[model samples]
Target chain A: MTEIPTTRRLDGHSALITGAGVGMGRSHALALAEAGAAIVVQDIVAETAEETAGLVRERGAKAHVMVCDISDVAAVNAGVEAARADLGPIDILVNNAGISGGMAKFDDIDEAYFDRVVAIHLKGTFFAAKAVLPDMRAKGWGRIVNVSSIDGMVGCPSSAHYCAAKAGVLGLAKAWAKEFAPWGITVNAVAPGYIDTPMMDGLLDDAGKAAHVAARIPLGRMGVAADLTAAIAFLVSEEAGFITGQTISPNGGEVIVGF
Target chain B: MTENSTNQPANSRFDGQVALITGSGKGMGRSHAETLAARGARIVVQDVDRAAAEETADSLRAAGGDPILAIADVSDVGAFAEAIRAVEAAAGRIDILVNNAGIAGGSPAMEEIDEANYDRMFDVHVKGAFFATKAVLPGMKARGGGKIVNIASVAAMGAVGSRAHYCAAKGAVLAMTKSWALEFAPWKINVNCVSPGWVMTPMVHAVTTAEWRKTHIDAEIPLGRYAEPWEVSALVAFLCSAEADFITGQTVSPNGGQVIVGI
Candidate 1:
């Protein structure tokens, strides 16, 4: 009934995806590469990042592996520099690297635990955007997609840390969008809802997942990587020039939000 | 629309889908038609202006799409509903419905606006989008799945000054889009809204001068320019595509950093 267009929307561009080892980040890398973008796959896990890079290369697009914890500002800057040297300047930045802590209510949550979650999700996003802005500014064109979540929009019970970090990224995208639009750069967030990714597997078992979907998600299923990736592809394409500072929630009707 | 457009199909995303776009007589609606037709949707051009609608049909035919015409103003609920059913009968089924039928509310301050003008604004944008979706839902549900994109404006998101009716109408459309997404999800219908920022449409040209363009676009708008119709159309077409199957209850604004906060 439908066919995904084979048009390469990102030809001659280089994209940097954080947390590209597995799940949503890996999916975004593959989809962008499929759209003709040369990918810089960055993740703390060197092996998985390389695995994603290999996948990108197999698609006949260039790929470079950069291994670094995105939370480390110095390391992220170095990785961006090395990635630029190996491939090209980052024309697109998907601030996708994130960490979700196991459920700990506010009383049980330790300072270290909260800091780590915020460090990885919010701090990591901020510094990564900082690292890639100069190149995009000079070029006068770029795309930045921050991967937020349903928890970000609507608060998640017992997952306040994750929610705060995720929501922080949304604010970051808005501020960056306003700041960078003059340079022809767009910054936006894609807040996904209950996606069937590795992250969910870590949080919920099969039964929990099914019950949640049946109770909450109207689509009657968990979202897939393709759903998020397709949105990222649209946000990064040339046709999306007029769009910035927006959060496109591909949640299968889970959360109907409006201005 | 050009081949460089995002909706320019390399393999036809909507190869067999039938898309019914209201207000296809001119502006962004026509571009939406072109974008979808390029991807192989059988278009049903619905517009009150017969002359302009015919022009759009001719272009669609030239672009290799066999389009149907439903010459009815969307605000005419009974007549437009009948026209929609005619489209369903003619085209076998309705797969996509773009509630793009709208008129520009003139720049009259809230007090200066008359009751008739206010009613006209809501009648076209709000009532039109609402009933049109109501008309199309059964066919879409029967067909297993469907995509509905309501065309909103950036004016709905902020105080754009004057034309409170237009803003209110678009704001209602945004709210209605949310309700529809929730209400229609059981039927596998994905309802969404596209709030474009300062597109260079007739609605804009009717109000602005060179000075308005130079100052307003450059000063207030971040991208320092307005959007081309295809730019907004490509986004609408994306929402209608299978790739966007999981996206519902969402409002995508391609407004070049104008009025970013939509919370």
Candidate 2:
């Protein structure tokens, strides 16, 4: 058997991950740290951010913690600046913070709920990307990976707000990829399907619901955070410079959506 | 132009792997072959032109790679199957298959397209990929897992003038890619599509003049330039590696933001 060799592909780089306290965000932070990048673990919960920072430290990489709500533009900008002050210029940014929002029919969705979901997933992605662009533009290199959902690509019933916001993330990523390509920045999106995370627990009523969702996946299982982390790692690597404005769906063959 | 930067260390993700790239004689297919071979894959260069296939294999051998030439027109199912068998027998196993053989027809209006042009387009792009996958599936299943990458175009998603046949064929390729991805998931085989915009290849050059390309095609692209063959190959190499083990049924387009802006 040929073993896949692991290397410090992101050595000397700095990364800031939103929602890094748990789930896919935490996984990305650790993976980036393992690849030799200093990490800025940002989340709404201070304790979880610190925990993620400690995990990064365990991997022998420097880490900083930031506790702020991603949906707030001012807070995101401030957090990004603070992260840069502590860890130097951020070379990578993962917009992984998002909320599933309430499941309701399109007509039943309230204005507040729709706005909140859009604020966190779509607007938050825009704000974070905007905050990091100056540093990346100055350095002439950067990588941004937005976390969209398979629901965004193929509409899901009772999740109109969530799906719309996720779809907006894809558009934001592509627009930024084009606008920033001259500065050597690459923007991409990762659409994960039915990941086994705390978020999944919140969405599913029980183990049976989770199993039912898993059964629908052609790969015969729900994706783990590591599955998405691997794709993000590849997209943010030095060799992946040419791949920009693309959406890589690591959905276990659940949906074959094209962009 | 050099396909890869010399400063970067060679990725050995495909070490001890065998890759069979259709239409490997020139352009993007050649780039795919070179990139994979450089990454430690033994090359099975398949093309309709025997001389071109030999040329690609010879270059691989010169670069300290083990390569074999297989001459078979991809549109011919029988010949293509034989070619696959020969490669599998020679290389011991086929670890990767790139369904990249394609032809571009003159951009005649859709109404003006005859049966011959339409059939040829579908035969080479759609049927070729279908039969190639059919031939490689059993071995991949027996061996536990493998990778298959089909080359598609941005036209599949949107319209392109005078190339309706080409667009339709690529769309079929995308559809088939998804179907195979679903069917092969249990066997652990990953299937994906690479939809490139206007890449700077000899075939592209043969089709359009530099002046027209600059004023029309290049202007529409946000990156303000067409992709180098290596740029397309880089994504294919990534898709074929262990890094993309979780990726399947995805159409990753490296089009300089052409299709994204709906151009």
Candidate 3:
């Protein structure tokens, strides 16, 4: 068999990853750096963003830190502008920042909590993508990977707001994929199942809930941050240019939603 | 858009492994075989035509692959079972199965569809994949785990012209992929589907003119071009690799933004 040689896939690309302070966002930031892309690590917390930037620098890749709450459109625009100014035009954007919005019964759900989740999860994704398009358009090359959840694809009890927001993110990805394809940008979403992250700890509530979720996964284990990153890495790669407007579910067979 | 080959390392993701790809004589199936075999897999090229299967095997051999040939109509349960046995006997075990054998039947309107054509479509796509998994399940379970990628179409997810039978069959494959994934999770078998949009292949070329494709199909696809078979194969290879261990029961589409447009 003819073996192709390995080379850095993102040697000249600069990526902006939101929620890069911890969990999947951090992992994505590190992985993109390792793949040779300079990173802009953005998080609501200044310390966490700096922490992630430190890790990115350790990998021999340049890192710039931006602190902002993505729910605020002005903050998102400013953060993205600062990232591009510091790191050059963003070639890749990973909208990984999100909140779980703690579970609430559908009928008793607080209007304020629902709006908060939507603003951050759905609206935030839209803002991030919108912010990066100009540079991507000028260069005619870009990749956008939105971090959604299995809850978005399947109904999860007591997480209607989270589900709706995540689902909306998918819609945004598809819409933007078409709108941006003419400019050589590809937009996709990743729906991760129960990954072993701080977020999962907050979502499951107990060991029994975690175990129950794990049992349902065909892979027989909770996914790790690396699992999610692997899919993200593939989506953001140059080889994946033909793949756009799709949602890849790395859920370990927990839920299968096609199309 | 410029088409530059990505310089990805040839990791032995499928080394010391045996893969069975149905209808691998040409098109996307051939692409899948080449991708997997290039990554160090011994391929079992299955096709309904012996000559076609041998042709694919010959190409694999020329590319430094130790390929075996299995000629059988997958729609026939007995033939498919016999073909699986032949593969096991020749290669020891099956570590991967790509159900890429499918026919694009005439796109008759729903009411105009004949029972014969509809049944043939379902028999070949849905039932063939179902029984192929059943045949390989025992060996894969005994060997610990395996990967199964069913080659579905974007039609499964949404409407596609008048090909109701084709869409229905592909849709069934998608649903069955999930069911098998859930049932075989304990056994460690990963089942997924790869749904492609408009791909530039002999089948497609025979049906549509280049000008027609450019004006009607390519214009609609967000990527502004039809997908090469290798692009589809690349995604399937990833799904079959170790890196994709946590991804199962998912329909990963490499459709150049077609699905997003919504039928």
Candidate 4:
């Protein structure tokens, strides 16, 4: 059989991903790069961020690395500006950097602790979006893919703060989608269920805990990072232009709420 | 603008393929059929009226393409099923289906909209689309993949005037889309719903005069004009393409500025 030539749908696009040092962010960075996007990779952890950048470069797309704590407004702004200057204006922005520390009772959680959760998950997203909004507005074409959690849609027992922040991100995306529709900027959110990321591995170190969580999922297994990366690539591509203001749940059939 | 093969590309994109769009006798349905045919999809022009359906098919044929006429009353299950059978037998395979056949029923209020009107809307928009998919599912599964785009409306997402029954029908369509998408994903059948905004369709034409449409429907749309059917069709074609394999169990809206507030 002759080989069927297929064109890459996302050719020549440029994408910037935050928290690309590890977990889902790193996977999405590499995936987008593979699909022909020049990548700007950022991670709170310097080494991991550089590693992700190297991976993108190896995949034949230009890659730049920036190390910044996205939770800090000043740092997030500086990092975005640096990346823009180095790689060109970003057409896609993946707000994938987030933290989910183990379960804690709502009453037991202090204000400071809750504030930190909002800082990284919610505040970081706003600041990064603020940094890139003008450029996105100028281009008249942009795709902002915010990474939310299944917790945002459905509550988890001991994750009040985590759930609230992710849920806030969903609200943020919807409001911005309406505001930016005229400018051709699309905003969307992706909520993933228990995926096999480094974050999950840390909590489910023992076989028993991992098995317990996997059993609860309808698919009988947790999702892999690649599962979500596949979806992220589609949403950020040109094909998904009409798909804005929607939240796609690639949770292996976990959250079953229909329109 | 681009040419694709019929087998769906190796990456599994809807490369060279064909689709049949019903209710495409005009409006949004016609838009989807034409757009897909432009992208290398053989067109199966389907409609209730034989002449209208043939007219749409002829246009596609005249444009350096071949299309088959698929005529039937979608409200009738047997008629819908037979239409799918004919399309499959003639086209050899149904790479895509756009369930865009629909009507708008009006009443003073929910209480006034009697059972007959309610059932009529369900028969064509919901039940008709249901059996059509059921008939094609096996063929699509056997062929190793397919795409089905259910034409839902924003009315399903929110409330509209005297449309309780219509809303109920589209709501069922939206729910059915999720269940079907999950069931069919493994077989590579990507089932999705495209909920269009207020569009310039015959249904709109019947309910409102040009003057009324300008003030009532057009003003409410964030984009300030009823969507041309082609805009809605373009999105549906993208979903049917291989580019959207990972995007099952989703509802894509092309409403100018109407946002689904929550959930």
Q: Which structure among the candidates has the greatest lDDT?
A: 1
Worst 10 residues of 2 chain B by lDDT: B1-10
User: Which candidate model has the greater TM-score, 1 or 4?
Assistant: 1
TM-score of each: 0.96, 0.88, 0.91, 0.81
* CAPRI quality band, candidate 2: acceptable
* Distance from true location, Cα of B205 in model 1, Å: 4.0
Note the clash tally of each candidate: 2, 0, 0, 8
> Stretches of candidate 1 above 4 Å error?
A1-8, B4-12
Candidate achieving the largest TM-score: 1
Q: Locate the minimum summed-lDDT window of 10 residues in model 4 chain B.
A: B1-10
lDDT tens per residue, model 3, B1-263: 11122344333268899999988987788888988887778999988988888888888888777898888888889988988898898789999999999998777887888899889899889888888888888999998899999988988876778888898889888888888888888888898888898888878889988789889765678888888776777788888987788888888888888776321
Arrange candidates by DockQ, highest first: which order? 1, 3, 2, 4
Clashing pairs in 1: A242-B254, A242-B256
Q: What's the candidate order when arranged by decreasing TM-score?
A: 1, 3, 2, 4
Expressed as tens digits, the lDDT of each residue in A1-259 for candidate 2 is 1111223268889998999999899999998998889999989999989999999999999999989998898998898888899999997999999887556789988888888898989888888889988989999889999999888888788789999998899888888888888788888888988788898787677776657655777777777888888788878886556567888998888887654
Q: How many Å off is the CA of B158 in candidate 1? A: 0.8
Every candidate's fraction of true contacts kept comes to: 0.68, 0.42, 0.61, 0.14
- For model 1 the local lDDT of residue A6 reads 26
DockQ of each: 0.53, 0.33, 0.47, 0.21
lDDT of each: 0.87, 0.83, 0.84, 0.76
lDDT of 3 by residue, A1-259 (tens): 2232322278889999989999889999998898899999989999989999999999999999989898888988988888888889998999999988577789877888888889899888888888988999999999999998888877688879999888888888888888889888999999888888897687676786667765686677888898888888888986577899888888887776654
